[model samples]
Target: MTLTNRQRAVPPSMFADETLMELPPPVRLTGIGLRFYVDDEGRGSATPALIRGQLWPLDTAVTDATIREHLRALVKVGYIETYSINGRKLLALTDWPSVDRGSRSRLPAPPSTEPLARSSRASRETFAVEGGGEEGREDGREEGAGEGGRGPSRDARDETEPSPFCRKHQPHGTDFACGGCASARKRHDQWLRAEAEAEAEGLAE
Candidate 1:
């Protein structure tokens, strides 16, 4: 399917969506863009190349790999559901509301046999910490530590290490003044609050 100029509604609640808020900025933007890019029934191609071409044709910076990463993030948060149909991968929004105007989607429906891999709230938070940005070092080693440990040893550094640095705020030298880290902390606190409220509501119901 090709990209179309179809108009779609953007609900105000989208801005307050906890799951979307937890994702990286680029991933969140891509998720919102996909909402407008999909068909009336919220079905669309899952191919990274097609997604990049459809959503970011003019933007040279947005690459297929970037789109793929964004899509993976979106799927993890349950903003979209991906499935394979006859070996062709497609995606659909998990909670697409009914629309009156357009015809039904021509895309094949997702199979009912397999369950969608929607991450729980705790898992989502873990994912954010690990993959949200440059916060957590993959190797668990400081950047530029030599092979022979010329710099501070891991045990010595662990005692003085502050919060990890965010992608935007880096090389702060063990300081907890990173704006990205602050923002991430705020989002995480908000998620905790929301989870508590939701649990309370569930108990009351």
Candidate 2:
């Protein structure tokens, strides 16, 4: 898959999403990494071996099982959906397009041994679901099953839900701060540090 090497937009709501806020930090970071690495379609393989090999120099004490558990946690929280293709697992981020505020691309049809695999034509059909911000079912079938399967519910409260961090702005993600409020705080801290450093230099002279 050809992935764009540009900065992906991470909504502040991600930090506030009840689904994400409850996850362990490593899992949350992994989810963010997934967004960065995957194609616009949010298609990628996050097998334990790949994650361990690629996800930076983590402590050796953290076993593959732990990583797998984190991946499962992401799935459970509705941030990702997993599909089995030819005995291999493929994951798709459910809310990527919404978070990026762009049109989602069609998933490349996988070569599959399973009969559930769709034809090329069907695969090209857009997988866009209305209100894709909601949590998927516990079973992990966000799009539902069979001909009559009722898919998971959309996050109706995404717009209406107030962020815990900012009253005016919805929740967003940041390394140290959230949205506008946290960014303001960061700038304020930097200004204070610069002032303090200048004062110390003058006193020494």
Q: List the residue pairs that clash in candidate 1.
A: none
RMSD of 2: 21.0
Q: TM-score of each candidate?
A: 0.53, 0.46
lDDT of 1 by residue, 1-205 (tens): 4545676777666676655677888887788788887888888989988888877888888998999889888766557778888889899876567888877889986652122122223433453455433553336533333243232233432353233434444455224232245434443454445445434433454
Q: Which segments of candidate 1 are over 4 A away from where they belong?
A: 1-4, 112-205
Instruction: Report lDDT (Cα) of residue 140, candidate 2.
Output: 44
Across residues 1-205, which tens digit of lDDT does each residue of candidate 2 receive? 3234546777787777655775788888877877776666567776776665556445686567977887788776556667776777777665545435544544443332123213321321233243233553334433532222332122321232223333323345344333334433433344445444433433454
Local distance difference test, each candidate: 0.61, 0.52
